[model samples]
Target: MIERRLKALANGPELRAHLLDPHTEAHLEAYAGNIEYGLGTVKMPVGVAGPLRVRGLFAGGDYPLPLATTEAALVASYHRGALAINDAGGCTSVLIDEAVSRAPGFAFPSVRDSGEFVAWVLGQLETMKAVTGQTTRHGELKGMKVTIEGNHVYLILQFHTGDASGQNMVTLAAEAICQFILENSPVTPDYHFVEANLSGDKKASAQSFTSVRGRKVTTEVVLSRQIVEQRLQTTPERMTDYWRFSAMGGVLSGTMGVHGHYANGLAALYIATGQDAACVAESAVGTTRLELTPDGGLYATLTLPNLMLGTVGGGTGLPSQQACLNMMGLAGTGKVRALAEVAGGLILAGELSIIAALSAGHFARAHRKLGRERGQEDTDTSTGQGDQP
Candidate 1:
């Protein structure tokens, strides 16, 4: 029974020795600690364990681009940000709701020769029976962007990339477009590094000089009532004090790493999703802020600089990852963005929970209990009294 629980609780070998009955009980104890510390269920009311509002906010925050991570107190620090403000008063919280990316780029380059390129592209479209003339009119191509640099043009083809991440579909489209351009256009066309898998790793060779054509993919959020009263646990004044404390702790420290609230949670989620755990270093940095609205509500927002996540590719397409994706209702179109959003929401919630604990002066106590358990086990071993009572 303990082994089964341990398998459910942890994925790999680092959890090897610790995968015992006591540790599993300890994990449950931590949840109990939450109750003891006055952290209520997320479903509860204001000053509860959940967020006050279920909305989102994204002002003074940039796009959640693909980026790196830090080893410092990142997730914890983000939690600190939440705590600092929550202790002062109630505040609004914008949880990341969702994110997705589309690929295949454009059928042709946009440039000085754009007229010729478009004509050529149209010719190719005419040749392909798969080209749905009506589909183009729909919003499927709404986020499409194009750019040119000399002979090289980049296409950032984006559709609503539902749940499956659409990476392969985009790549196929891009490859077809590149073929058409090379055959029809007079200009020598090149492509970016392609490894069948667009890992976006720096090491791949180029088929052409690929230029970034699309906008930095992103999703926005706004927080109002649901975020207040619940997530932060305090009113406006307390929120201000929280930010003051955060300012002293290098809120903008790139080297310092991810905000504290996201660290453990993201690590666990990423592991569950089969994402490269090391990449959490990049996907974690974000812009965190707290503001007061005219309506007297405290608002908090966090925009991750990079969220290198995929829903259908890599591990996401693998059996376990696919199962997890399915469990989240993110198995198909538009679901990847939904996954990102849920991740954001959970991360924000974690921030609130961590902050609430710290402000109420229980974080240290929780850690102390964990340490005491370890210490007692050590004493038992030394005295040859290792048997469990």
Candidate 2:
């Protein structure tokens, strides 16, 4: 891998005139190997594509999972996606964990903007725990969050859902919470309640937003519609079938391909970081959407809602893994999303390279002539000459 660094001695257009040369690059060598803070748990693969290793003080448990090559491609593709955006236009992406979900055996009640109502709900939660003979440690507790948008209030319930995304748990929690608020709170009974699960979807959703960028950054892919139509031997009208199989819940013409990019990047990062790779199965199945722009370019957006990738938790505090994380310059609490975003960007770049290769007809020929096979004919000729002599 080649690493390059640039520093501006002074501001303005003439700054390049005063730029340092390779001699200056030599003086900065000592600062090169210093590991970035908080990224001590990412083990890079040896070859161009190989197993990533992560070392850390991890609890003895089931945290290992085998990832497929296709999955790896998706991760690589998202990385490329990031590069594309960086080149085309400076864009920003904000990640929010708005999943108001829970575990199956837990329940939480929502409440309105009244101190008295909150007191009542707490009492009810305690009573419910007693009636069900359940404990929070045993995964029978409900989690809830409430946000204010102007005079309107929205409540979100989060459950420590086991295995599954815990959509049911969140739904139940939100409903119960809403019921509690309407009945006990001092606010009016006419407040609106929406049951839509918005966070984990592939397509963007609107709400009382906690975070957002100035411009929404979306990943778009353009595959010749004619080629797609030829691949499946179907008309454009049947593109919906392609969308269903490619990404569930996608509309006509196809589903979103962006999530495929996320899946690819995270798997590689997971393998490198010694994280629970299996979590990626659920992580990748999330929101994938495909649509078309007015100019006929296909757009894909994949938003993974439950990507529990961490930089400081689990195995991130180790040796070689730390070095790899240092190479990427990623660390800290809120930086996981930033890392994810970067990984997403890189995967997109990789995918674009892959797609372009296949489309350009060089994919097969590039690998066909490598290794001992390239010298097979020469070896055979040498053997024949020896026998004749």
TM-score of each: 0.48, 0.41
Best by TM-score: 1
* lDDT values, one for every candidate: 0.41, 0.37
lDDT (tens digit, per residue) of candidate 1 on 1-389: 33454456545344545433343344443334223422112211111111212232422211121111232223332333333333343233332332222333222244556545544554443343233223322223323344544544444443433333333444554455455556766644445421222333212112112221111222223334334344433455455456557655654652332244555656656655645565554455554455666766655555553454656544565444455556555554444544565456546645544544455454554444433444433112221111121
Superposed by TM-score, candidate 2 places the C-alpha of residue 245 at a distance from the truth, in angstroms, of 8.8
Task: For model 1, state the Cα shift of residue 233 in Å.
Answer: 8.3
Every candidate's CA RMSD: 13.6, 18.8
Superposed model 1: Cα runs more than 4 Å off:
1-143, 149-152, 190-239, 244-263, 274-285, 292-298, 304-338, 354-389
lDDT tens digits by residue: candidate 2, 234-316: 23233333444444433343433333335555566666654446655444433445454454433444444445455554445
